[model samples]
Target: MSELSIFSYLPADDPEVLEQLQDRIELVRHKLKFVELVPTVACISSLSPLKLAGGLVPELIRLAGGTPVELEDLAAADPQYIIVALEGSPLNTAMSEVETLMALPGWESLDAVKNGRIYLADGEGHFSDSPAGIVETIEMIGEILNPKQFAFGYEGEGWIKFGV
Candidate 1:
């Protein structure tokens, strides 16, 4: 995967940049050691309940020391954190989906919903099918799962807190 390629590159082919990247990676690793072992899920329900599986999203969740919950297990898993990707921006299509999910039967009983951990992500640059997008998605997931350890300042870039 191209996102995984970041590990193979030398950080812009510059010694200084490479060193900085390595340092940042090490810091993230150190912080991941303290990440709470919580169940997490990422889904793109633009058409159907298509959950992220065997891709960068799951890898990112694992890197953040979170338990990646599969779609089949979501109903029974009661995930603590949920990353929802929509076909458009949060203000438009995404917000509608969030509201639809919120209206589902017993949806409010989920841990993610009850605790306000349902994050809304964009489908374009934020959750694209490219490697760079995956990297950004990982960074965002890291910030969401362990803000103290992985504060990459993803306020309005890849995702935002889900709100009514």
Candidate 2:
């Protein structure tokens, strides 16, 4: 859809930029092909009311080699990777909120927390709905979920490992 939108509005004379975007998207897709059979991932975008991430966020997690835990069945799901990407929150602010989740019942026993797979990501900045942000967000997730396979240099800026 982002590609289609670009093609629809890009200047007719700037095929070069359009081609570049297409190439980038294709590369990301190809990388996604190598990611499969991953562990369950829990992506939370809020803490005050315990909101789960929705929209393309879950899709992106799947593409980045994660088995997204169904939001409706989260109580029964055992997540291996937990991502806290609070809407409108940067990395620092999101990091500060991890404690709230830790304090929740059964939080410390979760596989994600026990294995140190919790992460704080900059949702408002790099996890936006923009085409570029989506691509980068996928790469960042890939790096987080499958660190042995990917490293797009998004660490410390786009996301951070959280250990309680």
How would you encode candidate 2's per-residue C-alpha lDDT over 37-73 as one tens digit per residue? Answer: 5788988888888777877777777667777786633
lDDT of each: 0.63, 0.75
Model 1's alpha-carbon lDDT is 0.63
For candidate 2, the TM-score is: 0.82
TM per candidate comes to 0.72, 0.82
Off by over 4 Å in 1: 1-26, 45-54, 87-92
The lDDT leader among the candidates is 2
Q: Candidate 1: which pairs clash?
A: 3-131
lDDT score, residue 89, model 2? 85
